[model samples]
Target: MMPRPPAPAARPRRMVSAFTGLDVCETAGLRLAPGAARVLFEQDRWVFAALIDAHRMVLDRELIWEFAEILNPCWRTVAKEILLALLAPQHEAVLECAHAIRSVRSPRTCFRFLQQFTDWFNWLTDQGVTRLDDVTQHMCERYLEERHWSVPVPGEPRRRLEPDTMAEVVRAMQLPVLYGELLSRDGCTEGFAPWEGKSASAVVGLKKGGPNRVPAVPDLVLQPLLATCLYLVNVVGPHVADLLDVVRAEADSGQDLPRVTKERVPAVREVLARLRAAGEPLPALSTDVVGRRVGRYGADPLTHLAWGRLARMAGASVFNEYAREQVLPEVQELAAEVGIERPWARQAALIAQADSGEQVPWTDPVGDEDLQLMANYVVTACLVLTSALSGMRTSELLELSVGCRQSRSVPGGGIRYGLAGRLIKGKRFGGVPDEWVVIEQVDRAVALAERLVRRPQGAPLFGSVGLSDRVKNLRGWLERTGNREHWGLPVIPQGPTSPRMLRRTLALSIAERPGGLLAAKIALKHISVATAEGYAARPGGSQRLFHAEMHAAEEEHHMKLTLQAFRDAQAGIMPAGPGARGLIDALRHVDAQLNEAARTDPKVLTDDRHLESLLRKLAKALHVGPANFCWFRDPSKALCLRLAGTPDATRPLVGLCDSARCPQATHHRSQRPVWIGTITTIDALLDSPRVAKGEKTRLVPERDRALRVVAEIDAAASTAPAGKD
Candidate 1:
C-alpha cells in the first residue's frame, strides 16, 4: 500500500490533443465515416478508392437520401468509439476491421455495415461499452429486438426493427468475425466469437406475406389490357400506317387546313366549351402529350402556338379542331359504330331548351379529335402489350430504344425473340447491354412501337408521356372499353394497372403453376436459381413458393381422404382389408388434433398448425393403393415388393399382392361398399351353370379368398382401438 502505484503511465499528450480535436466518427478512407480522423495510411486509402469507385451510386445517392440528418448522428457516435479503441496500445485490429469493410460487394454495402454497426455500437455506448472487447452475445441479441432505424414517417407509429431488418443488423455485428482479416490480425480475441454458434432464429422470429409481398394482377385487368394491346398492334396500327402511306402517296403534297388566329380564338373556345359541357370524357393529357396532340389531332387552334406540329405539317393553314363548324360526319359515324351515344346529343338538347331566339338546338361531335383520341389509346395498348409479355420493369420499359427488337433461331425448332436493351436496376454503371428473351406478343408490340415512335429520337421507345400518365390512361381505356355497348366484355378492373402488378402477376403464374423455379429463372433473367427462390417467404428463405404450395396441395388431397376415412369410422362401417387397423390409428390422431381446435372455434378447424401436425402423422403410412387400401407402400414392409426384390418403389404392385393376406393393406368403412360389391360379383361368378367342375374348383378358392378378406376386416375393426380426442 505504501509503494505508491507507479503513477499510471502517462498518455502521449500530443496524440491525445489530436484525437480530442478531430471528428473521429466521420468516414475517412472507410474508417467508419468519410471525414473521420485516425485514418490508417495505406489500408484506408485503398478502401476509400474501392468504395467510392465501386459503390458510388449506393453511397452518394441512395444511402444519403435514405438516411439524411440521422446519418450524421450515426457517424458522430461511431467516431467516438473508434477514437477510444485506436488510442489503446493495439490499434492494428481496428485497421483490419476497416480493411475488411472495404472487401464488401459495394460502397453501399460497406456504408450499410458502417451504419448498422454504428447503431449497435452507439446503443452499446449507452449500455457502457468502453471497447469492442467489452461487447457480449446477450447484448447483441437485446439490440436486435430493441433497435430502430433513425428515419421515421412524420405522423406514423414507430416500432422496433422488423425481423428481416434485425437479421441484417446481426450480420453487421458479426462481420468482424466473418471476414478472415479481422481474425488473423494481431490483437486480443476476447469477444471475437460471441455469435459463433448462434443463428438468426435464435435472435428473432420471421415474418411472411404482407404489403411488401408481390401479388398477381387481377384477371379482369389482365384480360382487357392483353386484348387491347394485341388489337392496337395487329389492327389499329396498320390502319394508321395505311393512312400515312396514302397521304404521302397523294402527292396530296401540301394542302392546307383552316387555322385559328386571334380573331378566330373566341369561336374556337366556344366549341371546346360545348364539347366539355356535353359530358364527354376528357383525355388526361400531360403537357407534352397535349402539345403533341395539337399538331397530330389538328387541334393546334387551342394551343395558341402559330408554329405547332399540325400547323407545320400543313405548311400553311392550321386545321383547328374548334373551328370545324359542324361535327365531322366521319367522327359521328365512328362514334355510332362504337356505340358512344354522342355525349353531344344531350348537350344539343339542353341548348334547344334555352332557345335564345336565333338558335336551333345544335351539336358538335368529336370532329378531327377522334383519330388522335384513338392514337392515344393505341399508345397505351402498345405499352401494355410489351410490358405484360416482356416482364420488364417500368424503368427498363422506359429505357427501351426505338430499335429494341432482336430475333434468332437456335438449334432447337422454336424461334427465339430477344428484346435488346440495358438492365438499369442494381447496375453500378449505366447498366450493361443485356438482351431479354421474349414471347412473340412482345416482339409484335416492339415492331409496332418502332413504327409509332417519332423518328430522330433517342432511347425511349414510348415518347415523353410519363409512366404515371400512361397508367392513368390505361385505366381510362378499360373504363371506356367496358362501358361501350359495342364491346361484349365486362372487363373493368377493380384494381390499379401499375407495371409492378403486371410483372408480379407473371411471377405468381410461373411460381404457382406446374412450371417451377427454372421457368421463373428464364423469364425473370435471374443469374442464380436462388434469386427466383426468394419469391417464397419474403426476404428470401429456404422454402420456395412452388415447393410450399405443392406440399400444401398434396396435404389437402390427403386430408380429404383422411376425413372420409374418419367419417366411415364414426358410422361403424368397417372396411374389408387386412390394413384396416392402420387407418383406424390415423383416424384417432386426426380426432385428437381437430378436437383441440374445435373446442375454441366450434366450426371448421381454425388452427392451421394443428391440421399440419395431423397431416404429417397421416402421411407416414397412408398410401392409396389399387384393389385393397395399402397402409405401407414402403418396400421393406411390402410382402409383394420384398419377394420381387426391389428397393424403395414409389408405389406397390397391387395386382401382384396377395390381397387377402398382405399385412400392409388397411381396410376402412369406405372400402365396405367395394367389398360388398365384390362378394356379390364372386357369388355370380361361382353360380355360372356353364362352368366345368375343374373351372369351378379354381373359382371356389378365389371366392373363398374374397370371403376370408371380409371376415378378417370385420374381426380387425371389432378389436381396433377406440378413437378419442
Candidate 2:
C-alpha cells in the first residue's frame, strides 16, 4: 500500500482593515476584485465579514461577482439608504441574517437571498419586529401572503412576483428559526422552528412553470411549422447550399464582392415600411442614424439585422456608386432566387393565392424583400424545428455549436441522429455536455442550419442579437406563415417564446402516448432538478419530471372536458353515440370518490387515473370519420359489428353500418348536420344521369342511413327535455 501524501495547509484568511478598507486601497491575502471593496464600503461590518469570507474561504468568482453586481445598483440611488437602514439597527439580527445566507454561494442565489432578506428586514421592521426572537409562525405566514411585489413583463404589463421567487423569499424570512446553527446564540432566544407548514409560499402551486412559462405550440401552428421545416430541410436547403457554392466560386475568382449602396434605398425602405407596418421596432444603425419606432410590438432579429446594415450603408460609398467595380452579382442572383414561396388558399385559385399574399414562384420577380425574407424564414424554421423536436432549453438552444450532429446505430436496426450541446445553466465553470436523441426532421433542420453557416464550430447555431431578438424572430415567423382566417389570434399571441414551452409540449405528447415518462427522460436533457445535486448532470431528468407534469396538466385538461360533457348532457345536447350517456354515467360514478367540495366542484372529478382512463375509454368508443362516423373500436364490443359477424380492426367500418337499425348509431345535434349534408350529396349522385344501376344500388342503402340519422337526431332533439343540472 502507498503512503498518503500530507494534505496542504489552508491559506491565511484576508483580514479587513479599519473602517472597512477606508485606510488602505487593498487588503493582504485578499484576492477580491477592487470593485468588490468599493461596494463593501457601503455595507456594514456583517456584510463586509460575509463578503470577505466569500472571497477568502468560498473563493467562488460567481458569488463575489453577484455581490458586487447586486450592491452596485444601490451605491448611487435611494437603494443605498434602504440598504444602510437594514444594517443600522439590530446588529445581532443583521449578523444572524448574514450567517443564515452563507451557504447560498451562487451569484443568483446570493443576490436573491440578500435582496429578499433585505426586503424581509423591512417587512419585519414594518411589523414592529425588533429582533429575530420577535418572529413567529404567524408572522412568516403573514409575510408570505402580503409580500405584494409585482414586476413588469413583456406582453403582460403587470406580472406578480413568481411563486418560486416568493418561495425563496419565504425561506430567507424563516432563517431566524435556525438560531445557533445559523448565527451566534447570544442574541438568539430559546430556538424553535417558527415556520412549519404554515408559510403561504411554502405551498405554492405549480403554475406557469415560473419565468420560463411558454404555451405549447398550437396544433394549428405546428402543422404549418412542420410543413415549413420539411420544405426548408428537404427542398430549399439543398438549393441554397448549391447557391452558396456558386457565390463562393465567384468571390474566389474576384468576380464577386459583397456590396451595399443607396440605389438599394427604395427596396430597403419598402421592406422597412412593411416591417414598421407590422408593428415591429427597427434596430438601431451606427453613427446617430435613428430608426422610426413602430407602435407597441415585438422585435425581430433577421429583419432588424438586414435593415440595420442597409441603414448603415445609407450614405456610405455605394448604391450611388457605379464607379465601383461590379461585384457580388452572383450573390445577388442567388439572393434573387426564390427558395420557398408561401401558402396558398386551400380552396382558392392560383391567382387568389397571390391575393392571399402568396407570391408567384415561377414568373414572380424576387426582390430584396424576398431575399431577406427567405433568409429570415429559413433561420426561423431551422430554429423552431430544432428547438421543438430536440427539447433543448433556451440557453442550450442558443449555445448549440455547429457540427453538433452525431449519428449512431439503434439497437433494433437503422440509424438515429443525436444533437449534442453543453448545458450552461446551473453549472458553474465547465458546463455539462449533453445531447438529445432527435428525429430525422430535427437532424435535417440542423444540417440545413449548418449549411447556412458552413457549420462553424465556434459560433452559435441559431444566432440572434439578444433574447428579445430571438423572441421577436419567432413571433415574426409565426405571423408571416400563419393563415389569418384560420388562426384568429395573433400568431405569437401576447407572450414570449421560450425553450420550456418546446420541452413541455414534447413531454406532454410523449406522456399521453404509449411511451410515457421514461421516453421523455431519454428525449429531454436537464429535465429533472433532482439530479442537479452531486454536480453530475442527469442529462435529461427534467423530461421525466416533464412527463409527470404533463400527466398532471392532462388530467386537469380532462377534468375541464369532463365538466363540459356533463354540461352537454344536462342541457339535453347529447353527443352522437349510445356510449355518450354511458360515459356520463361513468363520470358521475367516478365523482362519488371526491369529498363534498370536489364532488360538486364542477371541474375536478374522479382521481387522475380513473378520470384519464375514462376519457381514453370514451375516445375509443367515440370514433370520428369524414362523412359518416362510428362509435366503436372492437367488433365484440360493438353491436353494429356483431350483427355484421365482422370483427372491427381499429375503428368501426362506417360503410357496413345499417344506421336505421344499428343500436350503436345514436344521433345528436352535431351529427345531424353531417347526416343532412350526406343525404344531399347522395341525392345529387342519384339525380346524375351518368350514375350506373349498380352504383345507384350501392347509394340507396347509404342514402337511407343518412335519412335515418337525420330523423333520429330530430326525434331526440324534439322528445328530449332541456334543463340544467
Candidate 3:
C-alpha cells in the first residue's frame, strides 16, 4: 500500500495552558510575559501595538527590548520626537537638505550631502553657537563659497543643490526653537547650540514672513493660460519639437517673424529674441518695420501675437496683456477643434473676453438642485463627482470595482476612511470598503453590481460602455434634455472645469468642517497631516475618534466574549484519528520544506510534479476529485484556492441535515464562518495482543460516522473554500 506513505509522521504535541498567568500591576498597568502581553495588547490596545510597529526603526533598542520582555511600550514618544524635529526651525533646513540629499539615488552622492550637514551641525556646536541670532551672513556666505555649490542639473549624473536652497535653509533655520532653548540668559544647554554672529532681530526678520511670493496669476489670466497650455499640448501634439525649433529660429533671426521653414529653429529663435527684446528698454522698432515684416511674410497678425505671447511666457515675463489675449482665442479654437463639448468651454470664452477688458457678471455657487440636475444631464458629472468624492484619479475611478466600500479596519487599529482620505489626497482611503458609497448614496448601485457580476466578470463597475463614447452620448442627451441651461451655474469664466471642482470643493468643505483641514486632508487622502492642516482656513472642533470612544463598553465586552468562544471552538488538541496526527505532521513538514524551497528558487516549489503530488494526497484525504479545484491567476493563488470548492463544503460542516431547510443556515448564509472544528470520540477495542472479543467491539453510531466523514472532507478542503458548499 505504497509503504503506507512512510508511516506518515508522529506529530509533536504542543502544551497549552488552562490557568491564568500572574499579572503584576504597576502605575501604568499590569505586565505579563511577552506572549500573554501580546494577547492583551491585541485585545485591549491594538493602536498601541500598531504605533510600536510603525516606530520600531527609530525606537531605542534597550527600551524596546525591555518592553518586549513583557508588553510592547508605546512607540509614540519616538514618533513625537521625529515630528517635533521636523517642525523645528534649525532642523527644518536639515530635513529639507536631507530630503534633497536622499533624492539623489546614488549612495555616494547622497552620502556627500548627508556628511556635509552632519559636519555643519557639528561645527556650529563646536563654535559654542546659541540661538538663531548666532548664525551670521558671513558664515552663510563662507559655507556656500567653500562648497562651490551649483544649481541642480536636471536628469544628470552630477547632482547639485539649487541656487535658492541656501537662502531657504538660512531663512528656515532662523525660526525659534520648537522645544529646547538654544540661548538661555544663564547659558546654553550642552546639546542646544545657537546660531552665531547674527542678532535675534535679523534672524526673526528672516523667519517672520513666508518665502518671496510669485505674483499670483489672476483668475481671468489663469483660465486662458491653462487653456493655452492644453491647446499647445493638443494642437502641436507630435510636432511639438518642430514647433519649438520654429520658435527658436525666430528668436535667433531677430526679425518680427522669421520666414516659415521646414527647419523651424531660426523662426523660433527670432520670435524669442523679439519677445525678450520687447521686455527690455528697447526702443520700438517703428510700426512700419513691423508692418513690413508682417506684410512680406503673409503671416497672420493674431497668430504671430499668440506665438509671441507663448515666447514671452517662456522668457518669464511677469505681466503681458498682449500674451493674455493671444492665448485665450487660440485655446478656445483648439477646444472647439478637439470636440471637447463642455459648459466650461463657454466659461473659458467668457473668461477670455473678461481678460480682454470686457465686463462680466460674477456667478453665485451652483445650487444642489442644479448640481443634481447636472448629474442627470451630463454623464461626465457623475464621473467627475465620483473622482472627487473618492479622491481617485479619473483612470483609477473608472477602474474601481462596484464592491468597494467606505470603511474597514486594517491590521492595526487605524481607520481608513473619512479624514484619512482627506489627508492623503488622490489615493484610496483605507479601512473602508468601496461599497460604502453605493450603500449610502444609491442602493440600486449595489443591485446593479450584483446583476453585472453574472453578466460580465472583471468589467468596470461604473460603466462597461467605452468612456469617451459614453461621454459623447451623455453630452448629446444633456443638450436634448435642456438640463445644461437649467443646471449651469453662472460663475467667473474659467477653463474646462469638470467634476474635479466637486472634489476640490469637497476637500475644502471637509477642511472647513470639524477637525478642519486635518479631517479634510484625511478625507481627501493626503500623504501628510501637515499638508492637510495647511488647507484649513480656521481650526474646527475635535473630530478624530479615539479607540476607547468608538465602541460602547458593552459592545467591547461582547467582542471579548465572542473571541473567547472562537478560541474555545478550536481548543481541543487531541489527534483526529488513526494516522491523522502523522498525516498532519507530514503535511507540516512538507509545508516547511516548500517554504525553504521557495526562498531558494520559487520555481522549485511551483513545479507541477510537486503540486500534483500534494493535490493527489489532499484529494485522497478529503475524498474529492481534482477537477473540483481551480486556481485564479490575477490576485493571489491562495485566495483563488479558497474560493474554489465553497458550494460543496457548506452543509455538513454546519451540523445541519439538509442545510437548505435549516433556519440558522439561512440566517447566517451571507455571514462568514468564524471558526470550524471536528470533535471525534475514539474507542479502544483491544489494549493487549490483538484478541477482539465480541463485547469489546462496539457499534459506531451513524451520526458519529457521518460527522467523522464530514470532518475528514473539511480537513482536506480547508483553505480551498471560503464557505460551505
- What TM-score fits each model? 0.43, 0.51, 0.19
lDDT of model 2, residue 617: 54
Instruction: Specify the poorest-scoring 10-residue window by lDDT in model 1.
Output: 9-18
Residue-wise C-alpha lDDT for candidate 3, range 1-725, written one tens digit per residue: 45454432222211321111312111113233354334221122111222221111122221221222211122222112222233232433334332222121211222232334334444555566533235555665555454435555788565444444444444333322322222212111223323552533353343444422322223352233233222222221212233223434544554444332334433334544653454321112222334566878765423222333333334432224544444455444443333222111123112112224343322112222232333332333334334433333233344454444344443656533321112112221111222212111122222223232322544345553233444355445435544223334222232333333323333333332222222111232332232233223122211121111212222323233223222222232112323334334544555575567668874644333453444343332221011111111112212222345453342122211222222111111111121112122223323434645554354244335535445544554452334422
lDDT of 2 by residue, 1-725 (tens): 99998543322221321123231113212233445534443343223333432311132343432223323232222222222223232333334333333221333344355666567666766676655555666776677777745655678765566776677766665444432332321122344454553453545553544433557765555544455455555555565554555444533554332334535545545544554455433332221111332223333322223332333333332233541223234223323342222111112222222124443232122223343344555666688777666566776676577888888775777765666776555553224666655666678788777876654585567865233355466556546544322223233444434567666666555433322232222332322221222123342543334445655655554355455554455566555445445454654664454335555667754455544554555444543333333445345666556767776555565556654554454455645666787889999999999999899999998988677667656655564474432
How are the candidates ranked when ordered by lDDT, highest leading? 1, 2, 3
* RMSD versus native structure for model 3: 30.8
Q: Where does model 2 exceed 4 Å of error?
A: 1-111, 114-147, 151-160, 175-200, 203-241, 248-377, 388-392, 395-400, 406-440, 457-460, 463-496, 502-550, 557-561, 575-715, 722-725
Q: What's the count of clashing pairs in each model shown? A: 15, 10, 77
Better of 1 and 3 by TM-score: 1
Candidate 2 matches the true fold with a TM-score of: 0.51
Instruction: Give per-residue CA lDDT, model 1, range 326-392, as digits (tens).
Output: 3234334333333232221233321211112233332223222333455556667778766665556
| Candidates 2 and 3, the one with greater TM-score | 2
